[model samples]
Target chain A: MNVPRHWREQIRRYRLVGSKCTDCGRLSFPNRAVCPKCNSRNNENYQYAGRGKIISFTNINSPPKEHKYNLPYAVALIELMEGPVITAQITDARAEELEIGMEVEMVTRKIMEYNDDGIICYGYKFRPIVEYAHP
Target chain B: MKPNKSVGIIGYGAYVPKYRIQNTEIARVWGNDPNLVPIREKSVPGADEDSVTIAIEIARNAIIRAGINPSDLRAVWVGSESKPYAVKPTSTIVAEAIAATPFVNAADWEFACKAGSETIQACIAFVGSGMAKYALGIGVDTAQGAPSDALEYTAAAGGAGYIIGSAKESLAIIEASISYVTDTPDFWRRQHEHYPKHGNRFTGEPSYFKHVLSSSKALMEELGTKPEDYNYAIFHQPNRKFPLEVAKILGFPKEKILDGLVSPYIGNTYAGSALLGLAAVLDKAKEGDKIFCTSYGSGAGSDSFSLEVTDKLAERKGKAPSVKSYIERREEIDYAKYARYRKKIRA
Candidate 1:
């Protein structure tokens, strides 16, 4: 029940709070302490809306032991509207329905739980926006 | 009783997950039963969604519509039966999520389905006493029913949140309210039990209808208003038939109740039943519209309110996503996915 890591990472996971270098206008996800591009220590918390399109995606017909119950799920690399790319499991849509450029949005979901009686870790996941943005 | 201070709802929000499990899918898994009727569909929480995350979404949406600084809220209360942790406080997490922490009184309240209303009543007192400028009351649930019980057919996930403040800042002023309770045991879940148990057919007349009718009548009689005076009516909808039937008995037309009877589409979200219904009606109500609401909880009691919409509602009803939007964006899941998502099966 003591997942201190879960507690520390909750803010970034819950609200998609990333990092942006005030010096170089560089953006980093997972709330980095320093700028990855300019190596600058000046940074601020950047809240990403988590709206963007998929760069690539795949169907996971086979999964790891803990995720076998959720078969035939979709995983994708999404470029956020705030200039960050992250890997996430796509939900609320079938694999065939996902296209390379299809739009997506973030939602908070259980990423992992230590055990039935233990701590549940929640994180952000992207789901496809069925209504195309262009329409 | 009339509150000494006039407290009103400055903002309200409702959240329903995108996933849905049709009653047909449920019937396919467990053949049609005698009791399963009128509940056509139900909202299902995503694999990661729980009462806490649901509460966060509800709080954020409410904050957007409230147009008040979250730090200004002095109290945050959550009412639910399906709390994620037995020992932890859901209100603290919700308050933190909305950036309203450290300076707030946070706690969880429980009264089966009427838990949310109980918190709302408390917030009414909190603001009415001038202890705080505003307080947040939330009713949410991600309740699970036993695999093959009657509760499984309609137990659903959803919630709504409200921000209570002075009448000058409110979208609707709570003119009057009344709560009627009795020592009736129609439904309950024992400590450590995974699901709730109920008295078959006994939950209807003795519990739901009795408390709902009594509270509604007491509030209306005290105010000297009739059902026709209200432009809209919302009831705790455990099922479609119950709300429609109860409204008719109270002399409310179908047209006045249909807009808020969301159980047919999303099932009984327990504590959220009446709060979500209130949010839905608020999205459509105009200035000067009078709204009647009543919430019922098994074991057993009801909370009724007579609210009048104001110009503030017309100005901010569209600030956040509407309840209709969440209902419109529905994705159907098969029983297998439903079982996995709902944790009826472990990976």
Candidate 2:
């Protein structure tokens, strides 16, 4: 019923990760219960994109409660350089600077915070690649 | 098996709620006159209804119109922006209500007004791929916006359903289809939200007229047909005037588009406007006639198709609920009734 924390982190970092059914070559975004392309329940294989281009983006002036703190945030549907388009929040640029087809690299960052009885809950978000520091 | 075969519309039916609120009534509620709203009357849903319920009613009517048992359908798809629940699939509830279970495919789809038509197209693709036999596409909504807002007059209630597959046993043949999509936020609503946010003038000329007209032109050109070739050109109606104005701009004569403006009377059903207009057209269309349809959705996209009326049209003519009858069966409610019907004012 919920996406796993690291899987959520993989997306927040713009790792361009998805599950590729070893049984069938069907690509899944945010993983899957089974391969819709092949109906295979064994989804053990996971892959990452690492790079993509923004297909479309929207600057949300008024967002939902889950995203209330990130007002004037940018949500983009990015077409991975490898395959498939996925939706995620854009990072590393002001709302005014984002445009369609802009090349971006995924970086891991804090996404959202939940106030559960005064305990802060943090989640992952994807930041744009402006300067990639080699490890 | 691949259902790459042609799936025509075997049966069709529509339902618009019986409460009609005049523009003057809305204007009066807002302390203005009728002309202030400029639009005409709009149909309103009762307290017991939601998009899922209305869709079920239409699907039931469609099954009846097609002269088939509801249990025979293999797949069901409900297309609407105003779904009853965001998480659970509304299609499952509708499928269970209409008894279209033990089937492979059933889901709720979103794309604004074009959702239903797109569902039809997807059903056709699925059936053609041999994945399904009969698929039902239902579009229904009680689209709500803030009272006294401009959208209040046009966001209305109604639904349309189509059972697709087979020419020998179908009501009409889907001759051709083309879709055009653009990334633009002309109109949208969020989860658990009652009101829709729109870009006003951006919804019309730039998004709707632009995408619909472009797709219609592309379809016409591909088919080597002109605007005059079609008996009617139905668009995802936001109001009474947009259809006429767009039709005129595209050289489709005035008469060809008037009957398609059912939204001015029934309000905008989100996904049901175009197909419902086609239902109105079917009530009068002759055998061997062609109907050009261009359906639009906000966030915006358009699906244009050509349908050829079949000989079987006469069999279901008077049996199913007619557009005129639904219009006549309505009861005029006062502003208070309207508020109650839309759940805008608390009891």
Candidate 3:
């Protein structure tokens, strides 16, 4: 929540930057120093294009202290089209409407704001791509 | 004054948050009939969205439509009144999000509704000077409306982004642009104020209409063009009626401006108002089509522009979602959720 820690992970948080194993061409959702597939240190930074499908989801009614503002929210495990799965908070849709395999796209949003004067953390969240088109 | 250099909108994009609250819903909470307000519904930002996020989405779409590298953008200028931070720059955040940081002229602008067009004017000069190949101008806002006030029915969340570059690579050439401003205290919000105040009846005749007509007529006169010459016209819409009324006064028929009048569907996006209208028109324009646009801001002024669609427009436009697409991808929300999203009910 402080400056240095939040600032250091901004690119990964904002852009969904993950690591791709250069050895076996496998991708990891959160970038790690070592490749998960080949156990090799050779990895490349791969920025996910932010579009994917919801593999699974959960409805959170009792949230942590900071997230009490959003009384009921949905969190989903999304499988990015490029082959990495990440957990993200879903927006613009209610929990009752969510279903497995619903398509979604990432958008930048405020993760949390401690207070009016405190640092606001911005990160990626996914929204349903319902009745949407890409050309 | 016409710039010596030929600058035009090479790539353009627009964004509207997916959630919408009907005017009837707001009226229901206030003990009034919602059908009376000009707009049918208004777009609302989700709890996590703000001017910065809206601008980032628009800038990303513009980058896609422009088919240019983010590194090639020489500047990223964002114009808005509903900035997330009182001190930090929205432009820098937008630039960094689009990966255009490190070598760009970035800044924030304010002029109420016309703030976005003000960026267009600045971008014209930036690219006209030949300082860079491309620059971006975006008008965005998560407009604030006091609970139960009339402005609440119309002030909404949305944005439009445009990429300005050489005429040769442009989708729409900027033939001419001019501004008309005056010392009018028609609408304003003081420091620390949560919402804006308007001079009611005075916001019309003396502020919105006067400046819009004055700048629009002058721009046409300077270009030596008539209303009949333009294939399309766009005007600032504070509601469903203002733009149409102004369009009629300017001698533009109802049909020419209808395609671009997005306010009736999404409410007034403040800084994004007229710029979003223009973006809608550009989405379907054909080569050689002429478009005239005018944007008005409270405090109060109007920025007018004349543009012509180029051959590249038809091909490059489809790369990103159209304004119509953003408008249609909506999910209606009740007043309770809307209040929570806008944070009207503080814990």
Candidate 4:
């Protein structure tokens, strides 16, 4: 079963949200209700600029039954500027285009969905944030 | 008189094979759509990989991670229902590979998914009794069942290890533990069968949830702790969703269960799942924080424990393989390869 195109697109271009701990000053993606460090319920309001660096990655040529849409895609650990590591799909780049500590930014995208029902699931992904020279 | 000797983690490690099999391709091959099972990818064991090799790998990492001398270990125990040989002691092979000579007390344990935690508990008992200075508890398996068998999507490969000793003499301390046992047959693998038989609905209420909740509640009550006190909660996950539902019922919030939820995407590593999730939580958990863990096995039993983060745990974060590092180190195997490995198709 194939994921609906729209969800794939939505997830291909998604945004990731996270919070930084005010106590230990560590970053947590997807937000934490309590600080794992100091046990503080008080969260320091911060959204990841969605920009990060790749720490490591792998190309998954095979996925699970529910994730038919994704094949031969790069899954990586992205270190957000906030200091927490995140696992997400790397887009707009092939297997060879990635490296450890490479700069990246989160993007919105469609991941998988109920194909026949057309219920799409969206998620945040990372893409290489390349620097370009002003012509 | 000295306080009850607290058990501590003296060594630790884990193993995830290089290959990954997509759940979707597996569904397609089985004449069903991917949606039949909500799985993403599963770790595939290599040609040479088995319960024994995986345990050895984790044991090596644990030894390296703990920085303890192999000869210092007095006992070795390998825990898994997926043992490679019927009569051979897998622990002996693991001990030899890690160079932990002449095991004073070495054995293999099996209790379905709870085998790993059970080994830890046994090691704790051994070390606390002064029968040994250091004992190794390793859990590793490459669980297999037929495709679209409900077990298919989540029966992945992985393993975890822990070295136990005195608190003053080790890594993470074991604060308290409680266990509950019942004779409910939620899951069972016969004398010579590769796959387990499960009563799904029965597993949910009468077995998995029941025993885990009973044991965890008893542990918390005995320790005078509450659900809100834990920084993280690690549950024996047969899949990603079961843990969350169990947590919700137990009054733990979603955030408390997120780290462990990674198993759904990674697939059910059986004995490795809960411990691996705990490893991930420990990576980011701070000193003095508490972690509540529960382990469940299919013949129906659970062991619940209260764990507090120690200064030692903080100092040892980067010393071993990081959870993210292990998850990223896998090679993806397609449906065909998965079928072959599962032995669904004969060579």
| Fraction of the true interface contacts (Cα pairs closer than 8 Å across chains) found in each model | 0.18, 0.00, 0.40, 0.00
Cα lDDT of model 4 by residue, B1-347, tens digit: 01257777765777676678887777777877777566688887754356776786688668767878888898889888887677768787677556686655679999888888888888888888888888899877788765578788888888788888888756567888878998998888888776788897787888888998899888988888899988899998887778888899889999988865657657888887777777667766777888899988888798887877677875666676666667766567687766665556643
What lDDT tens digits, residue by residue, belong to model 2 across residues B1-347? Answer: 12346668888878787778888888887887666674678888754456765776688668877887767787899888876566778787677556566554788888988888888888777666766677788777777767878888888888798888776777788877889998998888877667888897888888988998998989888888987778877877888778888888889897887766687677777788888888888777767878888888988899988888989888776666677667665667788877875667653
Worst 10 residues of 1 chain B by lDDT: B29-38
RMSD value for candidate 2: 18.9
Instruction: Evaluate all candidate structures by whole-model CA lDDT and list the values in order.
Output: 0.87, 0.73, 0.90, 0.74
> Which candidate would rank higher by lDDT, 1 or 3?
3
Task: Write down the DockQ of candidate 1.
Answer: 0.29
Question: Tens digit of lDDT per residue, candidate 1, span B26-71?
Answer: 8778877535555888999987688988888789889888999999
**Ranking of models by TM-score:** 3, 1, 4, 2
Model 3 per-residue lDDT tens digits across residues B1-347: 66679999989989999899999999999998756876899999988889999999999889989989998999999999998889989898788778897899999999999999999998998899888889999999999999999899999999898999999999999998999999899989999887999898999999999999999999999989999999999999999888899989989999999999999899999999999999899887899999999999999999999999999998988888888999998889999889888988777
Query: How high is the TM-score of chain A in each model?
Result: 0.86, 0.74, 0.91, 0.78
Tell me how each candidate scores on DockQ against the true complex. 0.29, 0.01, 0.47, 0.01
Per candidate, the number of residue pairs that clash is 1, 16, 0, 30
Docking class of 4: incorrect
Q: So what's the TM-score on candidate 4?
A: 0.71
Error of 3 at B209 (Å): 0.9
Model 2 chain A lowest lDDT segment of ten: A116-125
Which residue segments of model 1 deviate by more than 4 Å?
A: A61-72, A129-135, B33-36
The model with the greater DockQ, 2 or 4, is 4
